[model samples]
Target: MARRRQAARAAPEPIRATSMWRVDQVFLTRKGQRVEVICSLVNDRSGLRNLSVIAPTEDPREAVRHAARFIAGKGNVSTARNARVRWTREQSTTLQDELVRDEQLEDDFQDEFEDMLAAVRDQMR
Candidate 1:
């Protein structure tokens, strides 16, 4: 007697949420002799609706880059496919005030950023 064979099953694909990000404003604030760069990021797809990056740098470009990297490194990729980066002259006082009030809750993610860079370097090698 011949035996019947079972068919192979395919694996299910992973669900990925693409994040759409908008960089609304990039402003500078001076504290004593040092200048701080603040960038506002808005994401409607994920829970990170409104996010801000405060970098103690004189260059606004650097601060914006940091914000992009932060979004990528922090798993905020749900709507990253359609990223809009625009500089607006108007600053958001509400966000700035919130940042100042919650200074203790601020996280730079420097170590995580470094690790991500290292991983990419390793992959290239």
Candidate 2:
């Protein structure tokens, strides 16, 4: 009975599938003629450290994808562990909007923006 109890106690507990990092916000910003996607992450373990990703693009979907990829690629090596992306409906809308009416000037410089995105992608790699 003692040996059985000791063996049972030594058994490992099942791991829970919980995200250690949460995506706090996903927003867009205008930089010169290009639109950039920014993602804010919070470490669930301590909720003190944060991570941010900035991807240059005209499309919000691409921005989210880039951010996700960056997180998957870097999250493990960093202080973050098992991080997952989470955002509200309003934040999702931000990713869906390709062109904000208020940023009319940004609409005029499409080619330049694409070039900038390409350069940023290259640098990221």
Query: lDDT values of the candidates?
Result: 0.44, 0.46
Best by lDDT: 2
Give one digit per residue, the lDDT tens place, for model 2 in 1-125: 98888977766766656545544444555455444544455654545434455567755456555655565454332322222233334434676543333232223222333444455557779
Give RMSD (Å) of candidate 2 vs. truth.
10.8
Model 1 misplacement above 4 A: 1-48, 89-125
Cα lDDT of model 1 overall?
0.44
- Candidate with best TM-score: 2
Candidate 2 lDDT score relative to the true structure: 0.46
Where is model 2 poorest over a 10-residue stretch in terms of lDDT?
102-111
Model 2 residue pairs with clashes? none
Model 1 agreement with the true structure over 14-61: per-residue lDDT tens digits:
665665554433344544444444445565643334555565565545
